[model samples]
Target chain A: MPSPTSKPRGILPAALFAVVTAVVVVLGIWQPFEPGGGDLEIAGGGDPVRGEALFAESCAGCHGEGGVGGGGGPSLVDSPIDEETATRTVLAGRGTMPAGILGGTDAVDVGSYVVQISGAVEGAVPPVAEEPPLGPAGEVQLTGPRLWGIFVSLAQPAGATWTIWLDGGAQDALRVGEIPAGQTTFADPDLGIGTIIDQYNRVIIGEQLQDFALATDELSEARITALKALIIGEGNPPGANSLVSVAGEQFAVFSDHTRFLVEARDEANLANIRFHSEHLVNIALGAPIADVDQNGEPTNPGDGVGLLGQDGREGYLPQIDAAAGVGTIAPLAELVPAVEATVADARVCGDIASVEAAGPCVNAIEARSAKLDQLWGQVPDAARASAVLALERP
Target chain B: MSVNVFVADVSSGYADLMETVFTSAIVGKAWLATAAIVLALVQLLSAGRIYGKLGSARILSSRAAATVHRWSGRLAFLFTLPIVFHCVTILGFQTTDTRVAVHSVIGSVFYGAFAAKVLFVRDHRYPGWVLPVAGGTLAALLAVAWLSSSYWYFTEVRFGF
Candidate 1:
């Protein structure tokens, strides 16, 4: 029997809370959500070594070992394929090729390895076939007290040789002994100091290098002074270089995805565009290196979860969250909920803490959700949205 | 064999079997805990209705709510078996940290509280408020136990199996 004045219990709020808690638990257990495939899915640098094994497992049957064309697939060697073409072809699976034999970072890793071997196999030019980046022309060895294994993981497996260029000499393809990948030199390469700086920064933040020697024996004094600034910043946790890594990736990765979003829009592939939007939202909110809820580093995802070591690793979202999700990360906050809403509702909108901001998000989600198929026209707007996120990235 | 060794054997044996269904024992524990929480909520809601703390203007009459509460309570208890067995036998009692200490303390009392609540339900001679207090205490203890271990794992470590 019910009281005459009894009202229905507000079960909706309780149900909604239960649902959110379950999602959070899922996200916690499934840290490092997979990036749905796109041309730019695996942006920037990747470990070719890890990719090589993945390639062997996933692709060698069709593409042959070391990508030296087999009876089943064309020789990747001497192939003019750039990273973008390779990525798109591999993910979309052209001709008799199957789609998604590999995906996510593994796909990107294989792509990186494929591009490297494709050029290296037949004395070919760099993957991009561009003129060498010019800078200080000097040859120096990279050696230190630390085991080269750390750098090896960065590039070149043990006993497998890498070819860097002493393009400092008056020769093209001026090959140096096994150096790391980022110390890049295309045939007739014009090497840039930026390459060395990038590599050194990675070594500093990602891997602990005690007595890691930076061979500057042959360097000009001016170069050494610049190197000194970078060297001095090492050994400190969350160094300026670490911030640069996070901040830089936020812009670079987000910008790359924004371009992909535009392309997906042209194709009007709803899933693909939504995929990039998800990454954009990730850059704006979800993915973070640190556990935001706890003061201490989280114990899950034990792969250096809060180490802030990996230069290109995911952590900016956590950083923003740590900073209290405010005056920072301004990527089309207004328009984002419209797209994020398409990601199964106001879950993402809840991440936007500003009550005032959330008002439009809830409305936009409801209004524009039914029109997702026609969301292609909004690609240009997504690009603007990405740019908005870029301003607030790290 | 010693009790510690026997406990370890049982825990490992159960966990090894669980691996066939889950990626790891912890993962199995996670899903089980989630199921228990959902069922516990059902128990809470239905109990509220039966006690007149809530009214069933909807399809739920007092008798139906009582039935729902009983079944949900049984299922919820069943779901906690594997988790509690593994935790007690494998990990045992520990006060290594604040979270662990708090969880261990609450978990130690949960079964006792649950037993008391069950007895109180059957005994018409008991005071009116005792059963509800014991039942609420059991649920709160379970919630806190979940927050300490499984929740931490999902949030701080990994979310999916």
Candidate 2:
């Protein structure tokens, strides 16, 4: 080429080199897409040693010697109740149980012991099954206190009512009133904040016996409660040899909804991503009791008994945060307004207007949502299927 | 239209696509880098043959070596594009650790060297050994980049996708 002249255009190459270097520097500073799928060593909190005696005296009466059930209560051994929910339930009570029988720390310990014995926490205990406590389609089955939560959910709607025949042992009193929906009431006066539903209506939290159908589309809360009194007059879930709406019959809606939402993450517009995330967190914990999180001005009755609340398990949210590798993502309690602040930085900054510019925010959101998916794995399939029924009614 | 939306779509979509073939994007990158390294090996051998450093009888003919060198270099460059896409656009230059810092530092200048080499290919005003030296430097940079990333990925992380 022209006898290969000794003179070279140094300025052009230098300019090109400078431009490329600048591009890399800009890319480095402007964005950071973190990698997922690493070792998430989730060391659960709470000790089991403290929970032994508490489980023996307080829980053994109904749950049997080792929480095996076949007694007054369903089996807690090998069943699904997250530690947080169990701790709260032990502290507050559910169904026939009275509240404040144990210390807050011991409550966690009791739940942990139950969870360990039940093989709910997976790696914490030996592997019972290869897969997690999920159905084929990844669902959690609700039972026991969670079942009572469903029973309570039937009466939680604004107009729904239950004529509770408060069995004060010697069959003393009957509370036939408005009683309000989703209030943590001292139901039996001395029983503290405990859910007491003794017989009457179509609302059954457990399908143990099945045939629990009691259509409550228009039944007043009192009427519904009275009907429940008749069906389960003796108290405890009615025993049926077979079932119609078995382990997630109409519950396919939740699985489908969750799948759509998770898959939608790929093509998410980001505007509603945070909204859905906050919705999920609220569903896990309630503000003014069993109200659906972020649904109405005062929180609608959606899925009551958060997965992290009483009857679920403890340390669930913290475990999720640990797995995320992001450290303390959002508010743990169901504080509605503060949730929006969590995503304010990503959305408020007008300068971040492109994919590259939105890198840090995208990274954060992805890390969080992915970890939330892991939380679902802890829930049993039956609980997952049963929990969504709150959304099926008024 | 919004930055968050655009990023969410691109990053998740890309990750989901990579996950379809491999376990994750990181695994996909490891395999992709290995492929690039193989192509780079072809470039090295072919370049040696073209430079008469390698015996014609022991390797391909000079013309044949030149053809192989051109094609292998092009292919190697092509193989690195996706990796560069994920590293620069998605992960960027991370310096979380010694290995990562080295990878980031070497990776940042990789394209810069490519730009200089491209310019030198056209302009013959440089010394005779210039192109060879540039090519060697690129290979060394790529080798280190592979060591810090793909090698680390296979060794420190899981070996399988």
Candidate 3:
């Protein structure tokens, strides 16, 4: 019944197929192909229940039960305020009202609930904003308090080793005397131009209006110029600026700020260092620090005070704090110093000029890079990896 | 109403989990797609050997090669299901731009071509050129799908892990 030419069935190909199939299936299920870690869930619709609970705890005393205007707060019930306006009101606190202490998602959730109870369930859920195009780098606003924290954190035991490079000044401007954290007497603070109270009520220096400031004392003039360009602009005739220009310019500042912290051998500015470091981590992972207005542009532009719009600040503070509390910021904070040290050592190597002299610096950079890789390998989650990777390049 | 709820629940469940998995890992979707393409190449080669297109070398007997071709084709097809499910149920058939439009069109045709190949494979009564045409069309569609997506991802977004 069988032709003589028909070859007998071999078990090898079938066996190999089974083994390969098994491996592929296992790999799919285990998802071991992920280089860093699992994927991160971008923020989406808010949980109204959580929002309601947050409102009861923080809003009920002022706005009354179910947001029915009472006790000095206007009623949100059937309130004509749209979701955007409500979000702003809750975050910034209208008139005598204080800013809400809720995170961005929580704030949005609360806004949703208020809209729902007001019988405007239609359009209660706001449309998610599309990711802005990765435009050329432009000037980013870095906060004075955070920069001061980075400076103080990285300071040697004697004090922070660097001086602030101000515009229209012949030399780097050094702080004349110790200005305590809450003091407001100094004419100019270290980072920015004016003085203002941070969300913490602690008096802090204003935004750094200068083109750039030295992130670390050891940085060469070229590196300083590069870092400054990243912060403000390259002074490249208007539209030619880099991605640091219009969107997420804070990231560039944060990247260099963390790099400066690498040489920090003291605990003096550790708290400040951690605070700004956490902010950088949150922003990199698509956290909204500022609310773009209806025209899809940054509201309160050139406000010259807070990094975020007045309303955005209310929401930004708590979300960053929450991100810090959960240890999301810890690995990144630790990794920043390592990256900073490696880049600094590389710079030292580059300064040697002569190839013979440069060998040791090159070797040191290579070794430090290997160590950095090992540290990167130890990162436990994808969210951390995403944030870290952004800093890894620049 | 219940059906709509079920569909929403299922779509959200898959979309949220897969989106996280897609964006979190660096160029992961691209890499998985690359792996699928490599398997597809193997399917193409084995299919050719079965058809005697590789001259008279006869690396595999007709029976053995045919069996390998069938199984490899099945596996290659199976490899695309998750990606297809994600695209269809979550992303839907979007044509937002040129690249996406090309990808969506090829992706839709790929399933149709694949169905034809499977049907042809089961039936030996088809014309001589029919099976080859079906197989060729499926492979070509997959290549376009890969070119529009994974290739673009690697070159433009990121190449290394």
Candidate 4:
């Protein structure tokens, strides 16, 4: 070997090279970004008040009293879809469930509702279950009239009860027993409409059951009398249930030709459900009577009760006519003019906020209109003639 | 007669002999095939005389390299002849019926052009043009083969992208 050389390889350069090599190795190993995966924001918390309402209306029926599934649905209180995963599950669809469970604007509404009551997230747990109702469960006599008032508050009807007071009229002393806790008591003409009071006194509208309500006009009286007959237990032997069938087009199809269709949102298909679930709540308590909507078809004929006429007979199915039933939607018609005028005003004014307000207002009015139309439609002609006969005799 | 003499004279049996000679040449001279292309490029630089402007004698020595390059390119065509026969017999390009008729014709044209390039090398003052044309034709043929096979003749159908 030549004389031992004394030249520096420079510690700094070597260290720099080592650092760069380390960086490259780390970069290769830890590929931080992956292609093809999509991005989604997780659900934050939601309003408990809104959550409670949604639970009562949508989730409570299937998932038992507190997100515990009863007969038909799986309990969700400690389910797989925790907050982060719940958002993902809803967006992507789980096992057999399809997407958009509650589509349109209600999608957000319903999704927030599910996350709130699911108890998988913090800050939205259920209230401690209360002790069974204080009074004896046996002597708890919940009459039709008593049930109706409790249902109204529990239902959270769109406007205030006073609004109903202005429209439906008031009545006097009525006895209601066997009420559930957190329920309202019943009085004659619980709502304050004039005809409602008259009908209560006259007994044309009997001790109102949860299913029955006082219609605002004579036409409605005729319709309800006829419809009450076809219901399963109506005037039939004790314990008889009604059987009805309605059909509609299929919604989705897969490669195996298995198609998916639904009778309602936030409600399970009737075939795979139990009576004490949220789905039952929707069917028995939440569903409105099926009626011809602006599309001139029953808003939900596939799942809704068939309409009857004023004469104690089933109503004739009429073709949708824009003009004929335009303002004559017996129970729901009053809101139509305001809605129509709103649409016309939006056309004239052309301001976006005004238009936005107009659209929802129109939609709300339309839904009401559809309900009244359906109720009036059920009134049989014979009932109309009978009422006329009853009036003429006096 | 010697095999080379018979091939040079184009005798009746020479075509069969040519096939044998060319096949063996391809196996042994595959490396030469790569070298031949390099030599051709060197010859081009010399003929262009840019090296001569630099006053290097290396440019003057490119004549043999030019002759060999021309001969090797022509030999490549002979090597390709067996490929066609192999494709037809083993790959089944030719028979009573086949769909790749277009492929077969394009392949024949490619090989034929390669042979012509070698034969015509001595005639033109600037013979490099043939090399480029042959290269372009070979590339196009490869592209066609790859695309048709990769896309399955464009038969894969679906709803959207």
Q: Which candidate has the top score in DockQ?
A: 2
Task: Flag regions of model 2 displaced more than 4 Å.
Answer: A1-6, A32-394, B1-3
User: For residues B3-60, what per-residue lDDT tens digits would candidate 2 score against the true structure?
Assistant: 2334445555666677678755667878889888888888888888888887644457
Question: What's the C-alpha lDDT at position A235 in model 2?
Answer: 32
Summarize candidate 2's per-residue lDDT along A186-217 as a digit string, tens digits. 12222222233333222222111111111112
Model 3 B-chain TM: 0.82
lDDT of 1 by residue, B19-123 (tens): 668755666787888889888888888888888886535458889989999999999999998776555534445555677668666666666566656656665
- Give a tens-digit lDDT track for model 4, residues A1-394: 1122433233433354355434433432332111101222343533445544544543443344455543124566655344434433432234423221221112233455566656655665654435421211111111131111211222211111111111122444332222233333223323333222223322211111211112112224433332222121233341132111010010001000111111111243322111111221112111352221122232221233212122332222221111113223242243223323422332222222333333443343334444433443432222112221010000
Which RMSD values do the candidates have, in order?
31.9, 33.9, 27.2, 34.7
Two-way TM-score contest, 1 vs 4, winner: 1
Q: Each prediction's DockQ?
A: 0.01, 0.12, 0.05, 0.01
Give per-residue CA lDDT, model 3, range A1-394, as digits (tens). 3343554333433454455435443443343212111221213334566667667655654454566543225567765655555544554344444232232344555665666656566655422214321111111122331222222221111111212222223343433233232332222334433211111111111112112221212233443343333332344452134222332243344344344333221333433333333332333322343321122332221212222223344222123223323345344455546555544453353233344444454455445545554544443232211111000001
- Please list the residue runs of candidate 3 whose C-alpha ends up more than 4 Å from where it truly belongs after superposition: A1-394, B1-5, B16-32, B56-59, B159-161
Best by lDDT: 2
- Provide the TM-score for each candidate, comma-separated: 0.32, 0.36, 0.32, 0.18
Docking class of predicted structure 4: incorrect
List iRMS (one decimal) for every candidate: 20.0, 17.7, 16.6, 33.9
lDDT winner between 3 and 4, please give it: 3
In angstroms, give how far residue A65 of model 1 lies from its true place: 22
Higher-DockQ candidate among 3 and 4? 3
Candidate 3 chain B: 10-residue stretch with minimal lDDT: B1-10
Please report, in order, the local distance difference test score of every candidate based on alpha carbons. Answer: 0.46, 0.48, 0.43, 0.30
